[model samples]
Every structure is written in structure tokens, then in C-alpha cells.
Target: MSETVPNTTAPGRRSGGRVHRLALAGTLATVLGVSLVNGVTPAGAAEAPLSQSGKATASSSERGDLSAAAAIDGKENTRWSSAFSDPQWLQVDLGASKAIKKIVLKWENAYATAFTIQTSSGGGQWKTIHTTTAGKGGVQTLNVSATGRYVRLNTTRRSSQYGVSLWEFEVYGTGSGTATPRPSATPTTTPTTIPTKPAPTTATPPASGTNLPKGPVPPGAVRVAEFLAECPYTHRLPDDPIVMPGLSGGSHMHSFFGNTSTNADSDIKSLLKGGTTCSPKADLSSYWVPTLYSDDKPVEPTGTTFYYLGEGIKDELMAQTRPLPLGLRIVAGNAKATGVNDPTSSSRWSCLHAGEVGSSKNFVNCPAGKMLESYLDFPHCWNGKDLDSPDHKSHMSYPVNGACPASHPVIVPKLRQVLRYPVSGDPARFRLSSGPGYTMHADFFNAWPEAEMERRVRDCIRPIVKCGAGGTP
Candidate 1:
């Protein structure tokens, strides 16, 4: 454990507790805080740097004049002075041989806007790992990855600036460890329409009470044709047979809020609630459930990649002032798809953004420059076993259909590497157990392509999937 220093101000800086003390001028809010840290110590091990394992020990160097903003204590946080401006900044040292996968920064009582979290390998070559608006009064966790011995919190909240007043900070990481390389699978030809066919015509009365918007596309909607052009996976949705069956809306087989999928007609009804005719054969749906009430739309038919769509642009725009589709992601690679038999091929798809766009480049704007790590903190599954072994069983591919197998194994040559650390609270990335079976981790299911990081979905299923063993055959 590291020792806490008493509150002491040396000319331009201040230090004491982890939080910042501030003063305001009339209605104009300006934070005045600073801290100068000194003395350096090193973590004496070769384990993952930020695991729940790395421990911090107090330094041997005595406290200095504490006036220089550049003096660092060689750990998770730096001291700042509270007499100068609205926001102050400092950096952290992760030491050598470790690549940071995540960081959780503690906050003081000040509001922050334009602040950035940066990382450097040797306290030199810095990289903007993430940008976010600091949350006041508590802890704000930011996920990021960069090779560096020094991590920094650069703030812009000062007397004349617009930013947050930062306080204490805590950093986390998975020290140096071998990152998992993506495996390769086979690719399949594109489909023609949404999979899973619809049931016999049982048209319900005209949906009422849902005041969903109709026809006049939203202010920032992308045209159907434009959407198709940008999303290559659209080419696969023409008359796909899977949509015909309408199996109980399971995970990706269809859409469901949680585990249950009822025939309340709620899903289909929601889809068509506010939609209008795009063309004679191109009817679009915009509500919760997804359905296309048309026959021959000009754009290629396809199912919505809701998660990606929501994350990339649609959700962001809906939550902001100016609406437009901004963030989009696409992926291409070799991997066996669900319901497909060939394990020696690959496929491609546009996995992100099927909604509207907005003016803001990032998800949220901040007083200091916005921190970028929050959005990049992806939930990934981690299995204890390595995928490179020959005896390993393959996981399933996401968005399953009759053309692809539920799960398929593949191979890939290691190139650029990125480790996806798993967390405890994430339901999307966890381990479960059957009544009499071994614990099953999501990492045991599937993986995304190595070349593309945007298409983050990977199926995790067994090589021989059965009705109750996690897949339906």
C-alpha cells in the first residue's frame, strides 16, 4: 500500500486528500487545484500489470518542494495544486512490460468536460487512449489499452478554460501477457433476405396508441440505398428463409428483450408502427420489433445489427441535439457461420449503425475535452484455455441461420494483438453452468476477425451443438 501525504501547497500546487478543493468567481465557475508528486517506486514482478493482483508500495524518496507539476510519484496518480485554475492534470506510470487494458479514474466534486486519458510506454511516446467527460462526486471507470510506463490525465478546466476539476485517480491493467490472436474460419456467400420466415397472415387491427412516426424519414436518417452501399452485409438479406419460421425470438435468431419471446404481436407491431412505404415493395419498420412489410425493396434485404447500430450512430444520434448516422463499423473475414457446414470459409458484414446520426463526433460532450475510453471499453469473454490447441472445440458464430453452422472452428495467423479483459458485472461476458455440466464461459463460443475490430460479435458454441447443449439443431 502507498502512504498518503498531508495537504501541503508549494506556490502553484496543492496536495492532501484525493479530491480537489475549488473556488468559484461570480457565476463563472473556475476550478483552482494542483498537486506536485515526487519519489518513484517500481512493481517488482512480471505478472499482468493491472490485474486485481498488482500491489502498490510506498516510495523511499522524501517529499520535495512540491511546486513542480512535472514531479511524479511513479504510481497511479499525481498531486496537483488548487490555487491556479479550474482543472488540473497529472499522469500515471504502468511500468515496463505491461499493456493497459482498462483504467478506473477517481473524481473529486467538480464538473469536468474536456479531459483526455493518455498513455505512454516509456513516459515519452504518448498516445490518446481515450477521451471522456469526468463524472463528479465519485469514480468514473475508463477502459483503454496502450503500451506505456506512464499514464496521464490531461485536463482543461482552469480559470479561463471549460473543463472539469479533477481530484484523485486509480488505474488498472493486465500487465504484460500474451494477447489472443484471432482464428480464421470459412466464409459463405451472402443471403438474399432476412432469415426466419414469418407465420401465416393473421394481420391484427391497425396498431393504435403507438403514435410512431410514419414515412417522412427522420431528420438524419440515411437513405435505404445509401445504407445498403455502406453496409456490405445488406447483400445477404434477400428472401432469407430463416425469417419464415419465426422461432421463439431467442438471442440473435430474432430479437428479444431478455430471455422470453412471446407472440404478443408486440414485436412485429412495433416494427411497422411508425414506418412508411419506401417504394411499392419497400415498406420499412421503426419500432422495437423488426419487420419489413414490403416485397421488393431496392436495397438489399438484411436483418438489423442492433447492438452495432445502436453503438455506432443510431443510439448516439437519438440521444443528442443534431441527428445523423455517424459511427459505423464493418468486418470481413474467414469463419464458419452458424447453420453453415463448411468450416473452411469466411464471410463479411456491416455490424454497426443502422439508425440516425448526430453532429457530435463522440457519444457525449464534456466541459473538459471528452474522455474517449468509456465507449471503447468493450465487454469480452475470457476462457482460461487457449484456442490454439488442436483438441479445442470451436464456438458458435453469431446471427445464426440455416446456411451456417451453430458453431465452427477456424484458424488465423497472428498479426496485431489486442487482449480483451473480462469483468465480473458484465452479463454479456460471464460463465454459466448446466445442472450437471461444467461451467461454460462465453469465450468458449466464438471470436471476431483479426483484421476488423469494429465487428465485435463472435459466437461461442460447441463443435457438436445439440438441442439442449446450448444450441438448437
Candidate 2:
């Protein structure tokens, strides 16, 4: 289910403006006695990268090239340098309202000596969450308690005479919470409506007699599972270790789920060594897709229900299905072709309230107050020999006429990703970070523990049984 928060702003300020600084400053008076040390939380545990997926802005830019968005662009070399002056600030619109927990500021020598970390709803009135007078130049990791759609670094004093330049501004938290619904909002045009249908309460088991033998069955069987994720947001990196290595930014923008640390300079080895932000806390692998941009701004999903399924073999054949190997990397959907005309496109668009799924090559037109949803199915057939191929895609293939080809004969659990964006109709305003909708692509990294993955695949997936992190559906 989704939870809504009010978007009401204080009097005399527009949504998403920095005009309420005086009001926030007055409110800071009450918390002046609060020690800065009390706001620091232990940064040992890993958390999600919140700032990477949000829209960034600043009070004033030093130049046109160095804009405010650079601070959250996930590039340490690129920075948002403000005009040389006090009372400058940099802020990010998290796309949707979320429960924020921490903020990490990577400075570029020209840092702020005195600043307050503030949050806001509708970017109007702000609330101070953390404040510091003595600022360092390297990095400031502050744990804060605040919830809002916007987070800002309000600098009152600069450490240097140059300006307040930030190499990176990182926000971390469980991206949970929903935006208040706009009145008279329709699903086909408006870009901010939440999904109305709740996910299925119980598992929808596979058809009877579909289960194959106890051991590995024929090469053609299919398997399926469904899971839920809240507030899946965008980050700059694709976490597929084989496709992208060494923490470099992905070729395109990406919407990330599962593992929260996908944006960090990482690889398969680094991912296996790290923890996850998933509910089970056992799924260390990260999942990402091209970021969906509407009206040149990022739009985040409040919650997502994913359908993981395969096609090809019957129930008996499913028994032979293998678990996704550790470090397995798969890329699905074309990142260059428009989603509607690309023959290789696996995405099918639809609307939740419309009660009908659109063609694979067409964008769905939903009525008002609906959501634009996309279903992307990945190849289920995998080669038994290799986890990854040189081409990064040759190891997997789709089933042809209910049969696996000789090249990719091993059947594995297929992933049917159901991504629900806040945007409705109006395809013209929608674009992926890579380009237009046709350039949409997704990446998967196998971070599951070896033994656990094997057990689940053997006990549940192979039997065509629905399952989650723990066990049977």
C-alpha cells in the first residue's frame, strides 16, 4: 500500500524555491542549543544513495557550465560551484517525498565553514536537521532526522574566499513515502499519480502439472516469482559488474533497486563483499534500469511490484532450471532504439486502471489518475558453461516456440520487471537518461550468496513454485 504526505507550503513561497530561508532561520533559533555531535550517526552500515537520483539546483551558479545539478551527478570531478558569497545553498529534489536519514558532502577545497542541512516539502518552508559552524574541507558525513521531498545544504559561511564548491552531495536513506496526489489528476497526461492497485496479497502459483522431475529437467522449462520494492529511485551507475566495472558512471542514467550502494565504485568482487538494502537483507546483488525523465526532470516510483517469470519448457523441464550464478550479469532491452519501434524491445506498456495491456511496441494511454507501467521480460535461457560472454549478451537467449535453442540450453528463472512510473500518458515528455524511450536498458548483477541461491532455485524455482527471500510462495 502507498502512504501520502501533504504538500502544503508556508504562505508566500512558491513550490521549489529558496525564498523561505528567513523562516527556516527563525526556526533554527529553538534548536541552537542542540549539539552538532548529537546529529552524527555511525556510518559503518551501508545505505542507499539518495542524492544521485534527485534533481539538483543551487542559489547561484558561478558559471553556466558549473550548474547546481553537478553536485549530485555522481562525478567527483564535476562540481556545483556557487557564486562567491555567503548564504549560498545547493539542494536536490528527491523526485518524490522520502524519509531521509543521512547526507554526505564531498567538498572541493572551497567548502563551507558554517552550514545547516535542511529539508522541505514542496521546496517552500524548510526545517533544519543538522548544523555545523566549524567545517572541514574534505568530507562531512552527517546523520540527520528529516523527511521531505527536498534536501538542501544552506551555507552561511564559506571556508575559502573563492566560493562554496562541492565535488559531490550524497543523500542516503530508505526511499520510502508517497507524494500527495494532485486533485483532478489523470493517469494519461499528468506525471505524478501513484498506482491504485495493491499488489496481490498471496502468491499465484504456477499451473498444475508444470513441475518437471525432481532433478534437472529438460532445457525448456520456465519459472516465475513476484516481489515488491518501495521507492526505487535513479542513480548514475549501472551495477552490472561485467558490463560496468570500477565505479565509472554508466553510459546512461539508471533507476536502481535492491542493493543501495550500486553507485559506489564497485564490481562483482566489491558487491559480494558488501551488504544490501533489500528487505531480506540477503540479496546483495543490485538491479538497475535506465532512468525515466519526464519534462527534463527525474520521476521516481513510489513502490514497484516485479514479476519474475520465464517462458519455454513445461513444468517437467522447469525442474532442471539452475540458480543464477554468482557474478552473473545480464543486460535486457535496447538502450538505443525507441521502445515502441525496436523489434528487440521486451518492454510492454500499460496502465493500472485501464484494465488492458498495450502492444510491446506502443506506449500505453491511461485515463486520468492512472499510472504508466512498463513490463520488461529478460531472456530465460542461459548457457550452462559460462556466467558471462564476451558480448555481454550471448550467454542468454529467449525461448523460440516454447523451446530453448542449442546455444542457450540451460533454463533459469526469467525476470519480468514491472516498473510503474508516476507519469501517465504524454510520451513526448518522457525520456530515459540514455536518450528517448527506445534507449531504455536494464542491468542485473548476481549478488546472491552461492549456497542460498542454489537452495532456493532447487527447492522453489525449479519446482515452478512462487518464492521470496525465505522460501515458498
Candidate 3:
């Protein structure tokens, strides 16, 4: 996985400057009912439903049966129940900056007595727009004025011991109406028109072939390898011990696959000796990520396929790639960072045969008989020096311009991880144990026998052959 650099901008500047502008714009749109910016109608026009399209999350769920997305699913029968505690919150990402005018909450038997409606340009700092301490357990239509990409319901006091539950949490707004209004053009007696210049175009660098394996392709050769695994759900654990020490269970929740014994005490030696839950019994590696919960129950994947290939590499070049060494560990994607409205997030949600790929911000809904899918692409270039890096990410990097960089010149097989869950409906009702959908990340442990892995890479992966157990396509 590629390394991420943190943004060092001051928090005060972000909240005061950017947030203030959004608030001002939202207020104007709310009063006008239909506001136009940049010659286009905003998202809040006609009082359309906004919450259904946004991603939903919460502070903590009661169990696998009470996911936060349930509240925003537009179905009164499904409800979201938080942990039986104070200071619970339900949040939604509007996908983009929008002008919110109203919020409706349909409460279940368990409700929040004291709550506040808040908005945030990003998901971090929030500004409260409405608060009530005398909330009754029923449907509430609240008129609010705010503009943001994220809206949340912050509940402080529960009306019952059962915790806060909401059958539906609805938000209405004008979408994409939050752009700062452009100043009106000044008219002059001597009107002068300036000729507009064509925008300059910068050519993207072509894919480099420096690291490609020098060879001639065999006749009728095909290049691509895929395998299936019956990945199951395991307990959530802390980040890898080698990467983050002394922080057992400090990281977000994760659902382990393959090696069932993975935990805070796990190590390379333990993984090598541990038995696997996967088929073929010979494969002993462990793989895991934040567990996905729907309707408060853990949802496991079906028909999951793992694709191995060299990114943009020809068959001859792919044949030269080395197999993963035993005891190798790698972390892909960022779990700590929220992916809401983040287009750069590596996590992608889609459906089988849907032909459309959705990001974490706006997840795709699967039709009946179809399945929800998660896709993760791992790096293909390796440094050929260390089995692991200090940060657990530096040892591997993605191909730059379709070629490996000098520091990581060894081309290795790129892993395209696809997981399909058996649940269907609004993607909002689904979430990873780590937190929100955007916080999705994955971990992998190399536990296959050294000889077996090498043989498979040479005979199957290198030639782009699809195979499963015993390496027979």
C-alpha cells in the first residue's frame, strides 16, 4: 500500500473560514427555498430527500442487528439502535456540499430525549443548528438551516434504558448548492470584452517499460490468474502488532479470514504454525479487515475471488514476477482516515453484473438475488530488500506510470481482492466494524508453504492461469 501524508493545516482556519462560508450560503438557500449558484439549481430544490443518498454511520451499534444505516433507509420498519449509553450519534454524508433545510426523525420505542442536529463540511468539526431537550418518542419534523457535506444527530440523553433508536432519519436539501456565489460583473460605459484563451493541456506521462522482464511471449498465452476462497468472519483485533506495538485493540474493529487464531498476540512465527480455516488446508495465510455489519448482524462474503497479476505488465514480464515469501505481512488502505466523500479512497463498493462501481461516499444498492461487493487492489511493485517495513507499508508501492520505481524496481503480482456479501438493499444499511465504510482497510499474512507459493506463481500466476486448490484452472 502507498503511504499517506497527513494534512498539517491548522484546525482553526479550516473551521472558521471554510465552515463560515458554507453556513452563509446554506442560510440564503434555505430562506429562498430554491437557490441557484453558478447558473444551476442547488440540491435542496423542491425539498427532495437527501439522507437516502448519503452514507450513514454511528458512534456505536447495539450489536450486529442495529446498524446506523437502518435509520436512513426510508423504511419505518427498520431502525437504528445505538449502544445502551449516553453520547451516541448518527451521521450521514450528503456526498457533496449541500444546503440542508429540514430533518425528519421517526423514532422507535427507544428514543433520545435530548439531541442536537449538527452539520459539518467535512466529518470532523461540527456546528449545531438545532437542539431539543423535550423530545417525544414519535415522528418529528425539524426545520433546520445548514450547509455541509455531512449531517449528524447527536443524542445525549436516552428516553429509555434501551438506548436511542430511530426508525427513519430523513434529511432534505439542495445538492451542490454550497459553492460560494460568484460576484456580479460590473458594467462600464465603455464595455470591453476580453478574448478568452484556450486552456493549456498537460500530457500525462506514458507507461514506462524499464522494469519489464525481457522475453518473448509463448504462442496463445493468456495473462491473468484468479482464485476463490471461502472467507469467514473472525473477531476484531487491534492493528498488526509489528506495526503498532502496545496498542492491543486500540485500532478499529476487524473481521479476520483464513487463519482463525489471528489476534493481538499473533506474529510471523505464530501465523506460520497456525492452521487455516480456508480450503485446501495447505494454505495457512491470514487475511482480515473491519467486519461488515448489516441489520446488526455480521455479513460474510460469497463467491469471493482474489485476482493476481502485474499491473500493466505483459505476459512475459508477468512471468518474471516473484511469488510472495513466507511470513510476509502487508497492510493495504487506510483504516484511520474516514472515506466519506473521499474519491481517493482505495475501498470500492459495487454489485455483481451491475457494471457500475461506487465509492465509499455513495455506495451502490444491489438488486434481489445479487450481492454487495467490496474490492481492494494491492500494490504490485516491491523493493526486493525487506519483507516488511517499519510503517508496514513502505516495503511495497504501486506502479508509477505503469512501471515500478527505481527504489522498488522488482515487479510483483498485483492482488485484486473482491469480496461479495450475501445481503441486499440500500448500501447505507451496511458498515465495516472499523467505523464507516470510508474507514475500510485490509491486512494480509503470507503463510503458504514456500515451495507451493513459488510453484503456483511460476506455473499459474506468471502465465495468467486461473486456478484454485491444487492450482488447476
Candidate 4:
């Protein structure tokens, strides 16, 4: 493994399903479906300080109270503090697209020396609006021209020995909602013309990916209600298409499987056009994990199995289970674990042929000839709206009382990753790119074609019948 730290970072994590949503489109002053800033004339367009009404999130926080929300709460005394690490961020999601005018940063002692300001229109893509390599601490106001629904500060380097901290991060912008009479006026301060709306995200559903032969179920079919795929280890890269999207070389080393072209900029459209290394061939979904190393040498998994099963919920709910949505991104396990017994950690390791050794949160010393194995389970509950969330999680939840929670009503097949490495024995020799074995984590980006995914759900997962890669039981 090339890096020995958590590869991904999610800034402003406090905004991801933890804060109340802003009611921008509802009850706002709109003359003809176009939201107008109150007390502002057409000639002198006023920009709403949108950050106050929006949500803020971050990758990691130094403490629970020192959250991303503090930066956008319009309170200068309060601040957001990140874990002491490089490549952290803080982002705000304006309720709607807006014409970005200016950004103000009220810095504490810990300030970013190198950073980039990025914008996005609720899509998984981002545009760089501003970047700074030489940063002066204290309060700094930046004038920039950009339009986006989200504004993020990607901090690459910190001036202080501690992590980045922001007392107040403000964004001034006008709503992107259509305006009545289509005012051609610009900002009262230097006006920069921008489009009414950003282009719609590219979301063409991909064709079914799989060519497994369809045949009648044998009398002794597995009876597991599982749809499985074998995607062996393919490559190692420092790219995370989910948490670190659009920022190349921003993550720790990762072992990739299934998709051949997954990168920092990969989205559903890009994966659909790439080749797959999976057994079924058609499932181009990308799967990755922090690379494992033993004795300072990388260890690759010889056996990789992804199981989509209807095992967590009752059969009745399984019947209502929907196919994994396209472009869905999920993360499992805690990458920031401090040790094997960290409460946030959720990883399991065992030996393939040494059952007597038992499973553990950290690496286990398997008997001779036994291979080390890792398993991670992803949640089955779906929120049904957003394909991705600010924190990479929070859009999905684990079943409550054997059923999906009301907040996340959509039931989906539970996904579990089982990986078996060829080497085992001394536990002291094993370590993941993230950390110890307890810090093992995994990431999944869904690019499976709708038709193929639905078929697997209908014929196998929903019906509680074990099916092969071709969706036949």
C-alpha cells in the first residue's frame, strides 16, 4: 500500500440528513415562479447570504460540538474544527442553485494555507471556482464569480500544526430560480452574467451488464436468495470516486475491482462506458477498499465476492425491495478507527480454512495454508431521493426492528463484500492502508444497468430465490 491513512474525506458532514432542510422554494416571494429577493429591485439584484439557510458538513470533526454547522450558522464566536489531518474540507449546500458572488472566511488560529473553493449543482460533479496556495490567516474576503447549489472549501494544507478551523464561512449569492420578466440586471457590486440554470446531470440509464447463461434452477439450488458476483482484485490506485470525487490523488491507496476505469472523476456515465472484470461481465459497478499490506508488501485478494441478498428483512418486505439505484454510492466500516476496539469500527477478519481460529476485529493468526479474509456489510435501507449524500453515508440506514425505518422507507438488497487474501499467519504483519485491520473499510459505486439489476432483484432477491449471474435460479 502506498499510503497508511484514511483515503477519503467528507467535509461539512453535519449537513447530511442531520440538519433540517431549508424551505427555499416553499413560501418564498415569487412573482411568477421566480423567487425574488425581498426589498431588491430588478436593476440592482441582491444576493441572499445563502449559507445561513443552508446545511454544512465536513469529513471529520475534532469534537461533536465543533461541527461544520458552526461555520455557516452566521455566528463568528462558534467555529468548525476538523481532525488533525491533511486534506480536510467544509461545504455548504444552498437549498437551490445560486449565482455565487463572494465568500468570506473568518479563520481561527488553525487556518488553511492551501485550499480550493469548489461548486456543484447538486450533481456529483464539482467545478473549481477559486484556489489559494499562499494564505494569510485571520479574516479574509474572497471575490469570485461562480454559480452553484453547493460551495465547498477543500483544504489541502494547514498553517497551524492543528487542523483547519473556520469561525464563520459566508457565501453571498442570488437564487438561481427563474425570475419573472427575466431581469437582465447584474449584481449591485461588480456583476457577472451566468446562465439561468446549470445543465441537467447526465443520467441516461445504462444497458444491462451480464452474459451469465440463463438456465433452469437445479433441484438443489443454493436456496440462499442471493445474487453473487466474483470480482477479483484488478488494480491499486489512490482514487476514491465517491468521497473524493473530482479530486485526483486525494485519497490513500485502494484496491479496485469490477470496473476497469474507475477514477477520481468517475460517475455512472463514465463507468457505463468502461470494461468490467467481474464474472457476469455486465455489472460495471465499482468496488474498492483500502489496500492491505503485510511486512511492508502489498497483499491482493485472490477471491472477491459481492453478495446481494434478501436476508436482512422479512420476505414480505423483500417483495417490495427495489433494485440498487444507478449512481448509488455506499460506504461501510469506520476508516478513522483508533484501534481494534474502537466503538465506531465495524470490520471483521478471519481465516478461510481455519475456522477454529475464530473471527476478530483485527487480523487473526490463521493456521498454515489458510488465507486471511475480510467481510463488510452495507445497509439495506434507502432514503429514496438522493443518489449520494454529503457524508457518503446518511442516505442509507440499517433496518430497524427487521424493517426499513420510516425516514428511509425504500428496502433494497443488502450488500456484503467478502474478500480472501492469499497470505496469512502472523497478525503483526498485517495492516490496511487506512490503519489496522479494525479500520478496514469499503466503498461501492453502482453502475449496474437498470434492466439487469431489476431482473436480479425480481428473479432472485425479491422472490427469495438464489440466482446466478445471469439472473436465473
Best candidate according to lDDT? 4
What lDDT score goes with residue 103 in model 3?
83
lDDT, candidate 1, 1-473, per-residue tens? 00111111121222224333321120022112211112112333322123222111111111111111213222223332232344455554333446676564434333345577777655267789887653343345565656665666676553222223233345555455322111212122322221222332221222223232212222211111011001111111111112222333332221111112122232333333322322111222111112111122222122211111111112111111111111101111221223223332221111111101111111221112111110111111111123212212121122212122313211111111011111112122221111100110111111111212111111101110001111111
Question: Candidate 3: how many backbone clashes?
Answer: 11
Against the hidden true structure, what lDDT does model 3 obtain? 0.59
- Runs of candidate 2 with Cα error greater than 4 angstroms are 1-231, 238-241, 356-362
- Model 4 / residue 353 / CA error / Å: 1.1
Q: What digit string (tens of lDDT, one per residue) describes model 2 on residues 394-439?
A: 6677766555677777777665555667777677777677676555
Error of 2 at 264 (Å): 7.0
Ranking under TM-score, best-scoring first?
Answer: 4, 3, 2, 1
- Model 3: residue 431 alpha-carbon error in angstroms: 2.2
Give a tens-digit lDDT track for model 4, residues 200-286: 222333233333222233332322346777787789999887877787888889999999999999988999999999979989999
Considering summed lDDT, which 10 consecutive residues are worst modelled in model 4? 1-10
Better of 3 and 4 by TM-score: 4
Worst 10 residues of 2 by lDDT: 1-10
Model 3, span 1-473: residue lDDT tens: 00100001110100123333443454466466644332334455444467764556678755322456456645444456677789999987665788898787767666789999999987378899999999875667687778988888999999866567776788876764311211111111111111222222122222344442322222222222333344455445655544453467765556677777777667667877777777656677778777788977887775444445433444345556776766666666666554555543566565543322222433577777667767676666767766666556666776654456788777665665666678877877877776676666677777778777666666655554434556554
- Assess each prediction's global lDDT (C-alpha) against the native: 0.24, 0.57, 0.59, 0.68
**Better by lDDT, candidate 2 or 1:** 2
Q: Over 4 Å off in model 1, which ranges?
A: 1-83, 133-137, 158-167, 176-473
Cα lDDT, model 2, residue 236:
50
